[model samples]
Target: MLALGLNQFRKEHFWLYHVKPTDPTTYAAVGVILLSIALLPCYLPARRATNVDPMTVPRHE
Candidate 1:
């Protein structure tokens, strides 16, 4: 919805040179890239935490 609104605003006031603001392929690619960027850091820490022994965690605390 935001993209659509932005595209509308752009269409009314600005000229996009050879760009398609409402392209589905561009949207999907950007969505996937953003999702991967967001999830990678979270996944790495969770994966590392899972590898640690449960018995050792309380000893440190």
Candidate 2:
């Protein structure tokens, strides 16, 4: 659907040709980068949490 929408054009259009297919190497690199980015927030908090002692946190009575 996305490909179709991108490829579909009006009479006066900036793009007339179909977009080039992504290279496997490029795709793999992008996938790895995206995975790392997506996991960053979770990773940092988990790492920080592991390093901290929960007992040190102040408890509200």
Candidate 3:
């Protein structure tokens, strides 16, 4: 619904094509941003799991 409205708004206002596609440097920057976002969750979870309370959970089955 909102997408349709926005498309109509862009057509009426001629705003959609105002910005050009990013350059190579911008692509590199976006790639770095995406890579960092992908890795952050894995790193944070691994670090948190390493600090788990030793007393609360058995080390062996």
Tell me, by lDDT, which candidate is best. Answer: 1
Estimate TM-scores for all models: 0.77, 0.51, 0.47
lDDT of 2 by residue, 1-61 (tens): 4533553454235334642343355557867999999999999989988986677765632
TM-score of 2: 0.51
> Stretches of candidate 3 above 4 Å error?
1-22, 53-61
**Candidate 3 local Cα displacement, residue 41, angstroms:** 1.0
Candidate 2: 10-residue stretch with minimal lDDT? 14-23
User: Over the stretch 1-61, how does candidate 1's per-residue lDDT look in tens digits?
Assistant: 7878778766744335655777777789989999999999999999999999999999999
Against the reference, the lDDT scores of all candidates come to 0.82, 0.62, 0.66
Best by TM-score: 1
lDDT string, candidate 3, 38-59, tens digits: 9999999899988988776785
Could you tell which candidate, 1 or 3, scores higher by TM-score?
1
Worst 10 residues of 3 by lDDT: 14-23
